[model samples]
Target chain A: MAATSFQRILVALDGSDCSFRALDFACHIAKQYPGCTLVLVHVIDQRALETARMVHLQPMVEEIVRTLHAAGESLLAEAEAVPKRHQVSATTHLEQGIIAQRLLACAKEQGCDLIVIGSHGRTGLQRVLLGSVAHAVAQLAPEMVLIVREGAAASAGA
Target chain B: MLERILVPIDGSPPAAKATTLAIEVATRFKAEVRLVFVVDDSIHVLAEPSYVQPDYTFFADKMREEGEQVLAAAAKRFKDAGVKVTTQLRNGYVPAEIGASVKEFKTTLILMGTHGRTGWDRLVLGSVAQGVLATTDVPILLVRP
Candidate 1:
């Protein structure tokens, strides 16, 4: 059997600490396989903007959406820097939609063989209310899914 | 750096797919593949009284034998592919055994298959993969058949 090679790796970045950690891990993996490209993705969740519009004035909602778009762009910029620093080739994607659905669709569209994500590790009431995007992607994605925890790299070192 | 990859098989079709993926990963990383077959005797012990009863030891022994067969077949595939492979048989709950094996073997990654259970069935039975995710700190690579 030929060894599984992840030619194109799709990593979800949301500017969270854990998400950066996942990017670091993905970069390391990309370095291992020669010519592997890391695709950095950040989704501007439209549902969140919709919720803001429902609870706020039109002008306020527009301002919030602008802020969100700016944040997403900066997050993608930061993610791109990680791979650049490591000398790994990468591309950035800014998307809009449900976070998990967009992520799955992007991975398929990009022809990514692997999807790397960070788990928030939420529990109890908060988890039920917020739900886990990583969990949903892991359960549904056609490609292999790698769910990186907060301290996964450190734990692996020890 | 992944040094040891743990994969649990139960003689299911999904398990076969997981094994294939695990071997591919191990071969790429030059990591050892540890194949574990968990003989979950708890299911038998917890069965309804209406269920047929056999000697506990007899049932366990038979399960162990079957598990060994499953492990051997999986091990051969890895060995044939030139990946260093080891096999073990554990007697206990599936998720618990998988977690224990991860710690005992110092596994760097766990590559396992999921049956993709959803809706009411998922809530009622719960998923072993989800249980492992909650209990273990090791990184998991979940593959669907």
Candidate 2:
């Protein structure tokens, strides 16, 4: 039997309430494992950028891209607080691309054994449109994937 | 705050891996655990399209025996870990039965195995992982093989 250790965890955040919910669970779990490293990441959606480029002129497109990157950085920065409160230190990364794929690549690069992520709580109609990042990551990732939903956390109250 | 844990076992290698992970987590958190085996309802539908309708009694009896064996094997593993565990066997669609257990047990966490491999492997556990995600809002820890 292999002794499993969740030594390295990658938490994917998208600045949604659900993502923060995921961060909460990640922090809670990382707190249990001594020397466990937390890597926080927020990827700017590439599809969003494509839409911006198509709908605007070159100057506006460039402006939107910059704003997107800036927003991503701030999102990661903001997410850092939750881990700190849990007494867990985390490194944050802001990357622009496909959200789920980039998160999985980072997990591979970091040698992470676990990937903690949150699915948007809106499950019914939203699922029809396809492309939920958490679901995609869960499907694609070889590492262990934890899909945290609203009210699923221990701290969550009904 | 990890109060209760639910593990759905299918006797796959990934399921074994997930069970191992579940033991570790359940031990660490000192949480209650429910080991459930769901006999997928598809067996009844599949029995159709045959020249002869297979004995319904045989299918039910055979599936019950299989489900119990799966649950008992998993239960022993958890018991060996010094974690107290309860076993549950249900007959229904895999994901929906699991979702029902999550609600009935007030499960705080779910540990499951996803084969994510091709053909039969994918259908056995991989699709169930995705199916559970779609049906329930609970946090699921999916161990892949």
Candidate 3:
């Protein structure tokens, strides 16, 4: 058997500290493989904008699109910064729809062999919801999932 | 006497891959392997046709014999590769019996092919792998086909 090669990796970024740590973890793993490809996916959950549509009464649909694009670019920029700290190649994308669905679809489309994601994103809810987007990706995706917990890397480093 | 490992015979290539890995590990570790075939009871379920005459004891026996043949044939691969091996037969859940034998023989580790066989094959045939993994904290390496 050949050494386990992580050829393609998908990193989910939502501009949260946990998401950034996940990106850092992905970069660390990516450097171990000879020709690994890292993909950064920022999901724009359109459902969140539904409530704002009622209050503003204007064309919230267009506003939602603009906000999503801006967030995607910012998230992608943050992801790019981490890979530059190491020696690895990366690609970035902006996805729309249900957060988990879009993230899974992106992995399939990108042909990622593994997915590294935060256990919880902006919402650090540890109760009722056993999993965040990362946990869902781990369960639903055909590939291996690396659910990075907060402070895992730093503690590992220590 | 086994610094090496022995894997029982199942035709599943996925399980075979686990055996191959076991062989490599054994070779590297300088361990001798003994291949054992357990005449697991579930062979009856795997042998019967969907609409056959209900009684399966006779058919199950015949299937057990066939399983022994598979084990014997599988043992040859190791011998040919110049790896040391031995064979044995047992009757029970493949995993439970295998785990018991592993302890009895003082086997180092158990390697298995997870064919994910279910239903009667699963009911009578518990996952030898899962059983070993659960019961004995000893290492179990599962190969996915």
Candidate 4:
């Protein structure tokens, strides 16, 4: 039996509350494993941009995509700071594609042993329309996947 | 703050891998490990002919015995590793039982394996790991072998 040593971990961050919680959890694990490296990723959904382009002017769509990429870079920079706060350094990646596919590709390309993600815990129509990217990544990723939820029991009570 | 780690194991290779992973995590966190085997009788019901059937109790008893064996083998590994371990054999829907076990044990984390099923099989059978994730608030660490 292979032991769980998570030497390289990939964390998907989208600047959402839940994703930040996952980042915190990843940092904790990295702290626990002295040699562990955390890779923070932000994927810009190209499909969304394409849909925007179909409805809006080309220049407007290009501008929106550019702004989104800039936001992704800043998001990665902010997430990289998280691990540093815990005294653990992290690498960042900004990619454009389907969110789940990009995250899984990054994990495989980086040889990540584990992929950590935050669950939005969406239910009903929102879940069906948006779908759960974390769930998709969990289903497809070859590495171990950790799904983190924020607030714990306290939020459940609310 | 992970006081207990809950692991749901079937007699599959992936589950065995998950057990090993759970042990590694438990050792690192200094947490007790709780291994649960859920004997899902609903599958038997679905497979059986509606007209004629054998004693459900008898079949359930046999499944419980088999679950015990699987649990024993898994528990032995943890014991040999000198990790604090506990085991449970639950007879119910696999996902629901696991969710209840998490609450009853106050499990800080759930560690289990994902059966890498794709296409029709995954859609029709669904996944226990996904079900548990949907139903429970507990954090899950899924190992894919």
Candidate 5:
């Protein structure tokens, strides 16, 4: 059986509250494994870049990339606190690609044993227009995946 | 109300591990397991010679026979564990057929092994569990082997 006891863990983050909720779950898992490696991955969706490219706007593209870089860095910084608080070690990576594909590719390339991802809690109209990234990654990743729905983890404590 | 579960088996170790985990969870829930196998008609046709034109009926019969043996072995595992066991054989897309059967048999849940066998194999064909998840609303418990 593929190890439920994770040695290498990957958490996909988007700087959303839901993503932070997933990070919390990842931290809990890392605490359990103790020796496990945690990787925080942020994928800058290619669609955002394509929008900038369509308008032939270099300035927009630069601004978007810069904003995304800072967001990725801050997300990782926030995630770093989780592992440190738990006395665990983790590394972070920020990449540009299609969100789901990049997440799956990084997991495979990095030899990650498991993935923890947060569902965007999208429903109704938002779901129909923008498909869930978590859903797509779970479909695409070959490794074990733990899906934490928005508020599900917090509500569980309640 | 199916507190017990049924997982179809094909003798592949990936499927076997899935069956094992299903049995564990079903046992935990105090449920029984029913094993099912579906013979994909395409597999038999692809194996046939176009020049000689092997009889399709006879080929399907052979596939059913093979499926029975696979399910029988799977049934034995659960039966040995003192879990009520049943066997079924069907024909269609594996995931859709499994979903239909889950409803038909009133299965409470479906459990599947995600990776087929090895990492290399999964990186190639994607995953059956992934396909099932996309197709079905039924809650799935995926096991990785």
Candidate 6:
């Protein structure tokens, strides 16, 4: 069998420490295969915005959305450092939607062969097999899904 | 840096697809492959031996035979790809057995197919991939083949 390459990988980052660990795995894969590229996508969940709108007035909701979008952008920018540290070429995307759906859609839109995400992210329930986003993407992603557990890379190397 | 890759097979199409990917990955990365076929002894577990003395042993033996065949076929594929490989024929709860073997093998990566049940059926059956994902701390390459 010929070697199967992960040509383009989409990584979902949520500005969480674990998400950065997922980025580490994606970078490792990118470096493993020559010419492989990375697509870093951070989604601003619309559901959070909806909840804000429900609880607050329109002006307050707009302010929250703006702040969330800014946070997402900064998260992507921070995540970009991992690929750069590895000298891998990557593209960044900031989008708004349901967290898991938007990540899958980004994978489809970017034509990524693999989708990588942390096992859990910010606000995840402790001791859960997967955070809700990881569970949904693992079940529903169109392309291959790589659910990266935190500290797995270190264990693999050791 | 994938040092050891674990592959679980059950002779399904997606399992074949996953094995193919595992072979390719092992070959490229020089990773050792630990291939396992777990004879899901759910029947034996659910029906205790002292309860009814059903002929479940016959079915368990048959399943073991099938598991061996599947394991050998997949191991052969990996061997042909010039990958270092080992095979195991285990009988027990499938997911739990896999989790145990992951620790036994010191597996770094798990590559397996999504047990293709969508919608309500998927919810009902509960996937092995999901179970293993839940129990293990390794990175899982879940292929929906």
- Best of the candidates, DockQ: 6
Alpha-carbon runs more than 4 Å astray in model 3: A54-58, A128-130, A153-158, B1-145
What is candidate 5's lDDT per residue for B1-145, written digit by digit as tens?
2264658566678788777766554554567777878776666555577735665667778878988998988888777777787889998777677767775776655666665532465452334555555454443444555
Off by over 4 Å in 1: A121-131, B46-57, B116-126
lDDT, candidate 3, A35-136, per-residue tens = 888999998876677656767755777876897799789879878878877878898898878888999888899998778777568764754222467546
TM-score, every prediction: 0.88, 0.88, 0.52, 0.88, 0.56, 0.91
Off by over 4 Å in 6: A2-4, A150-158, B45-54, B116-126
- Weakest ten-residue segment in model 1 chain A by summed lDDT: A122-131
How much TM-score does chain B earn in each model? 0.84, 0.86, 0.74, 0.85, 0.79, 0.88
* Maximum-lDDT candidate: 6
Query: iRMSD (Å) of candidate 2?
Result: 3.9
Candidate 1 yields a Cα-based lDDT of: 0.80
Higher-ranked by lDDT: 4 or 6: 6
* Candidate 2 lDDT (Cα, 0 to 1): 0.79
Candidate 5 lDDT (Cα, whole model)? 0.69
RMSD of each: 3.3, 3.2, 9.5, 3.3, 7.3, 2.5
Q: Give the runs in model 5 whose Cα sits over 4 Å from its true position.
A: A1-5, A121-131, A154-158, B1-15, B18-112, B115-141
| Positional deviation of residue B14's Cα in model 6 after best superposition, in angstroms | 0.8
lDDT of 2 by residue, A75-106 (tens): 88789888888889899888878777899899
Looking at model 1, residue B2 earns an lDDT score of: 69
Q: Taking candidate 2, what TM-score does its chain B reach relative to the real chain B?
A: 0.86
Which residue segments of model 2 deviate by more than 4 Å?
A: A1-4, A121-131, A151-156, B45-56, B116-125
